[model samples]
Target: MDKKHIKALRKIVGEDNVYDDKAHMIAYSYDATRTRYEPDAVVFPRHEEDVSAILRYCNDNHIVITPRGAGSGFTGGALPANGGIVLGFEKHMNKILEIDMDNMVAVVQPGVINMDLQKAAEAVGLFYPPDPAGQDYTPLGGNVAENAGGMRASKYGITKDYVMALRAVLPNGDLIRAGKKTIKDVAGYNIAGILVASEGTLAVITEMTLKLISKPKL
Candidate 1:
């Protein structure tokens, strides 16, 4: 990466959040697959705006931006193969924004852990059932990106089944909201569906609204 680009990234997210050192790059290089591809830099986006600005700058400069979660996927989806910057969300964007019992829904940032949501839902007599093998360690954003399925998938379905809506940033830095929190949304193209399992090719998901269900009797 050029010095100007690095400086610009620091300006957008802050000096501390941008790491261009070899150690940081190496640390963020591999996923569960164990394959390594060191990125030019590893960036921690504190919010949606940070992500937008970073992406806008990167896009304009023709730089690669790899959106990463917990690095728990076997698919190596989180690997910074092309080497630009790893846009990591686990830093500050990991939060369960809301849990609406009335509507049986959840609002969450991309960095939320899968099991965290499951436990939170269970606490309220609800269930968020997609339990990938790495649920205990994987982030919800990675699950959604991979459309991951678990042992319970035969009965409960996979990650895409629970997704209600998605807030994502396009390659061109445009922010878009797709799908609806309501149970039924037939108003537009199934953009959310396309994004799910796209594996970071289409856009970077910043937040997600997921549908919940009554806790299954044990």
Candidate 2:
């Protein structure tokens, strides 16, 4: 991107929020992969709108965009194959909006930590299944990106199954919604399923509507 673009982004997210330092870029270069390469820049968007705008800018400039979440991926999913923009969700958008006990669901941002959610749900006698080994460090968005499976998967299924809906910032910078909360609604194509495993290839998930299960009352 040009100075003009960077300047605009800095205005939107502030200069402190944007990092072009070599050291910072290097740290976000690789994930759980053997391959490694520094990103041209790293942008931290605090809100869904900011994420959409940044994605739009990158797509317009033909700059590759890598969506990063805790950098805990195992298959090099977060590794930047090409030098481009690396978007990290660790800093902002980490709130868990609500745990809907009546419907058995949780509304959370992509950056929410797994254990935190588990703790939150347990407090309400509910549970968010799909307990991956990376539960300590992995974020929900990254888990969804990999369809992350764990020991409990045999009993509870994987990330994809619990993902009822998501708000995504697509490659073209257009904001889109995939899936829905409704139990049985054969709407448009299963675009959400396609986006989940794209691993940053198709779109970046900003928010998620996950299905929760309350503890069986005895």
Candidate 3:
């Protein structure tokens, strides 16, 4: 990685948000698997536009980018296979954007924790049923990436079933929105479906709209 490229990335997110020091690089290198592959640079983006800029820069420069969440993934999706850039979402993108009771839906950033969303929905008498074993520590984005499921999977289904829509930035720096909030949307190809379990190879997920269910009176 060129120093100029590193400086360009620092400009996108800020110096404080970019990491390249040996300590930071080593820290960002591993996931739950404990396998380490150091990235040339690690960036923590706060917004979709920031991600767009970074993706565009990397794309133009032919640099590999690994999108990472809370680092709880067992599949090593967060690992930077090639020494390029790792885009970490845990710092600034972890927010539940909306909890729409009427629609039984929640719009969230990729960094939102799975357990946090569950608690928020339960507080409002709603349920987000895709609970992985590491729900308490796993980010929703990683769940979606792995299409993870847990004890309730036989009854409730996996991550793909509940995801209604997604906002992702493609490798070419094109920002695209797929799927819709409506309960029954068959108007076009299931682009969002293709992305659900892609494991960060296709695009960088920014926001997700999850379909919730009414809390069962159990």
What overall lDDT goes with each candidate model?
0.92, 0.83, 0.92
Writing each residue's lDDT as its tens digit, candidate 1 over 1-218 gives: 88899999999999999999989988999998899999999999999998888888899999998988878778888999999999888889999999999999999999999999999999999999999999898889999999999999999999999999999999888999999999989988999999999989899999999999999999
For residues 8-72, could you state the per-residue lDDT of candidate 3 as single tens digits?
Answer: 99888898998888998988899888999999998999899999999998999999999987777
- Model 3 stretches with alpha carbons more than 4 Å out: none
Instruction: Please provide TM-scores, in order, for all candidate models, with all chains considered together.
Output: 0.97, 0.94, 0.97
**Where does candidate 1 stray beyond 4 Å?**
none
Q: Give the per-residue lDDT digits (tens) of candidate 2, residues 1-218.
A: 46676677787787887888879988998877656878878888999999888877777778888888877777888887787778888888888988888888899998898888888998999988788888988888888888887888888888888888888988877899888886685878988888877787888899888888876564
Residue 144 lDDT, candidate 1, scale 0-100? 95
TM-score computed on alpha carbons, candidate 1: 0.97
lDDT of 3 at 87: 90
**List of clashing residue pairs for candidate 1:** none
* lDDT of residue 24 for candidate 3: 80
Which candidate, 2 or 3, has the higher lDDT?
3
lDDT for 146 (candidate 2): 84
Candidate 1's displacement at residue 196, Å, is 0.3
